[model samples]
Target: MALGPASVKNEGTKEFDFTARDFERVRSLIYRRAGIALADSKQEMVYSRLARRLRATGIRSFQQYLDQLESHADSPEWEAFTNALTTNLTAFFREAHHFPILAEHARKKGGPLTVWCSASSTGEEPYSIAITLCEAFNSLTPPVQIIATDIDTNVLNTAAHGVYPFERVEKLEPERLRKFFLKGRGEQEGLVRVRPELRQLITFKQLNLLEGGWPVQGPFDAIFCRNVMIYFDKPTQGKILSRFAPLMKPDALLFAGHSENFLYVSNAFKLRGKTVYELNQGGAPVRPANPGKLEKML
Candidate 1:
């Protein structure tokens, strides 16, 4: 009996035969396609997320879906495959302390400040960067330029749309709400839109960090790559950090995720603050953190 789409059991809760080999194939493919390292623990997550792909293609098993993926590496399904597997947990002002440091940097750097929010999941992080710039410069049209990039095309589309549920921005100060977002009304109620002025300051693009070349120039004042390195192994993280280091000025800052510690991974930066690092000569000491948890993530 040949494995084909007809063999699929699309009934809800139907168990697909997901084997260890299937998991390893997916792990390797995602790493090659986008430089994300899936841990051994992510097996269930991998199955749960890509099971939808199986259903979508009417393919019964993980092996069939992965086979389809390998056969059509350039297909739209490949994009969907990468998107489905990529994690995207983000919010406005998440890791709020970073923004204050960002605001201060923008103020000191003066006009036309450049920033890159490398993991701009669901648009909030880049939009927050834009809002911080607006407040720092005190203008509806702030003198700042931001490039927001993400590996997942799905989230990039959402970021470009710049719409969010009402509750997403409710925690923001009323002043910021009035200044940067338009409350949707009538048919569009219960949602908010990022003000055009704020949107203008940002450019959202789809980029894979492991790509040989980026489409944008650098020498940026700051780069917010938070919460992303936790998904990669130390060597992969170090390679990414090395690439990021050159794009920034010597005084530039790199904001890392809460659980990430780059000290042992990359010697290009020194610890400046909690989860913050400044690019300097080399070999800067890392701040104290729970080494056990950090090692696991690294």
Candidate 2:
């Protein structure tokens, strides 16, 4: 039967059939594809986005549409399915404190530096890192590169464009804002783009944290995987941590979400402070019982 524009609810029930089984299926598919384990509570969100597709295609039930999706792997509907479910909440310098710490580490190291923004949603975090580097080292004599990655292809494309609303640029200081961003004009009013210099410093790509054999080379000096791990299960978190440990330099720094802690994950790194970890090089490692005692060196 052809589906109408109105949302479909199952017989003798308040919840849509799509709301029941499809939600769980979508959640499983997301975890399998992107390693993001969504809570069962997000069923409504899944229903809402998928229901839009149903209306657009005039499909009556989620079951019929899901069958079509499975059969037509190359369809645009499949692509939309992936895009709609991913979260893309990010801001330039969302956590301002991390940038200064990163700057200090880069300046202290004083040579070729490679920084990875592992969960760089829409490119804000990595660009912030690049700006901090530019501010720290007045000259670009020493080579530095920022690698920004996200699992969502839609956001990666947006990030590579480097265009954002003017409001997003307002977070920067006036001088830095003028220096780093170009105000959109004429047809592009209300949008701003990162200057070529800052944009050039970042390499954006699509990467799934759950997948094996990372596409980019590492031995990175620092990595910012902030606010991304809260969606993962502990086992997945542990696996990701183990994978990152070998990719980092001996004294490399790892930064995680404020809500995340690595104490139970692994002993590969010593806690330096809240959500900050220092790779245990040759020195004796000291594990702090509480994050409070660890100094914020930056």
Candidate 3:
């Protein structure tokens, strides 16, 4: 999910000729493929990101590259194109306030906690959820299961490994850093790996919310969909929320990005707190409970 100002990279040395028609064609393709609505402000940014694809495939121009795509409906380049424009900006305990409420919700449930980090990027957000549950339950191996998912397979690959540079974790409180992560040593210095306990609590997968069917099964206690909806238009956001409503437990909470508000999108959810939503009583039709085994994920 892209945020804030559009990029201002110098366009003078661009290797490929990226025309307005090419840009519009790209906007249309990505919208239908991934439900992303590229703003006119993102033209410079689009050119910069997709240029690498042109280079990678040895295509000489944006027109030729897009032509290859229009010709082959199932080209692997579609995946690469979607990944290129997808922006993943996340940090551990990002939008930090959401964790405390999630912990308290788990406490009230009084059973094993199940969470879905629907936009987890590079493992940080879901790992943060795991750590919060561990602290709330006062054990590293608390009865918790987390499924971390993202549309970008590239980010999911990094997340599945549970590794990061030291800077990524340095701001975390010292005790949390010690308990939840293994700082690299010797040849691996300056890199950190999430403690295996935390890693085991999560299963990483690629999921497109717009896709017809989701592999996920739930009555999940919580769903963290922060920062993701901003990329989608109102209708796309509403459709995803409608799908999410059924998988959620009646009391389940939906944590959104600081910049997002779901109230207008669907009646299924109502704001419970700052950027947090819970099912509107009778606002959604839920699926039957199917509490599946977490071991299947491992």
Top candidate by lDDT = 3
Residue-wise C-alpha lDDT for candidate 1, range 136-252, written one tens digit per residue: 998878778999999899899989999999999999999889888999999999999999988888999988888899877899988888988887766677778878888998888
List per-prediction Cα lDDT, in the order shown. 0.82, 0.77, 0.85
TM-score of each candidate? 0.89, 0.84, 0.90
Candidate 3 stretches with Cα past 4 Å from truth are 1-12, 284-298
Q: What are the per-residue Cα lDDT tens digits for candidate 3 across 57-97?
A: 99998889999999999888888998998989999988899
Residue pairs with colliding backbones in model 1 are: none
Q: Report the C-alpha lDDT of model 2 over 160-254, residue by residue, as the tens digit.
A: 89999999988679988888889999999999999888878888987878878787788999999898877776666767887888889887899
**By summed lDDT, which 10 consecutive residues of candidate 2 come out lowest?**
289-298
lDDT of 1 at 61: 80
Quote model 2's TM-score.
Answer: 0.84
Worst 10 residues of 3 by lDDT: 289-298
Clashing pairs in 3: none
lDDT of 1: 0.82
List runs of model 1 lying over 4 Å from the truth: 1-13, 282-298
Runs in model 2 lying further than 4 Å from the true structure: 1-16, 55-59, 69-79, 140-142, 281-298
